[model samples]
Target: MMPNTYTQIYIQLVFATKGRDSQITNLVREEIEKYICGIFNNKGQKVMAIYANPDHVHIFFSYKNLQITISDLVKVVKTESTNFINEKKLCVNHFTWQQGYGAFSYAKSQKERVVNYILNQETHHEKKSFRDEYVEFLNAFEIEFKDEYLFEFYD
Candidate 1:
């Protein structure tokens, strides 16, 4: 006899441009976002929300397929997305994601709030720098990280 297993997991993945270059210009933000969304969808991951600002990206998804680890998922997302941006000529300069990313887990109850937060990245960044906001998220989630180890961001 064969048996089936099932599981559910939710994650909010955040990453930045190499050096936080703010290279995801308004010109190609939507295109890059759609591309990234397609990657997640193609992998059968359900995306709750996705947002790409000039320097960073926020993705909230359900990791229904445990076959892939967070590290593997991030690597693929970054590599494929970078190739996509370059292939599409989305930017005058080459595009690449930073070396590290932030993956935050949340209860199902917090889904809506997280979605709204991702959707409002533009508005939120007007008031708080990405660095401050990133730090706030780390603190909120109680993740231990050193400032130097964090992604490089331009002030």
Candidate 2:
């Protein structure tokens, strides 16, 4: 008999527009969010929550311990989503995601909290910029990041 692999992995991913530009305007944020969700769903991943802001995006998803690496998943998502957005001409100019992304894992118990955070991004951003919020996440998780690697956008 074959052995079974059991695991529950939840990830919250954050990535911004190239050059920290605010390209994901209200005009197309929802569509882009849905498109990204579709990508994860197609891979048999369960998307818990997703939010596409003016300058960045937050996605919480369930990863079922697939053969693919996390970096590969993020790369495909960014590449394919950029291609989809550009092909649809969602923006006046070309659009691209930043080269680097922030991915943090969480316990299943914290899923609801993470989902609420992603869902209430609009209100949260009203109080603080995404840059600060992201930095906070890095700090909270004790992940060391160089200044240059971090996304900076003056909103």
Q: How much lDDT does each candidate structure score? A: 0.90, 0.90
List the candidate 2 regions with Cα displacement exceeding 4 Å: none
Per-residue CA lDDT of candidate 1, range 1-155, in tens? Answer: 88997766789999999978878888888888888889888887999999999989999999877788889989999999999999988887888888999999999899899999999999999999999999999999999999999989677
Q: Against the true structure, what is each candidate's TM-score?
A: 0.95, 0.95
- Candidate 2, RMSD to the unseen true structure: 1.1
Candidate 2 local accuracy as lDDT?
0.90
For model 2, where is the 10-residue window of minimal lDDT? 146-155
Measured with C-alpha atoms, the lDDT of residue 91 in candidate 1 is: 81
> Which regions in candidate 1 have their CA more than 4 angstroms from the true location?
none
**TM-score of model 1 vs. true structure:** 0.95
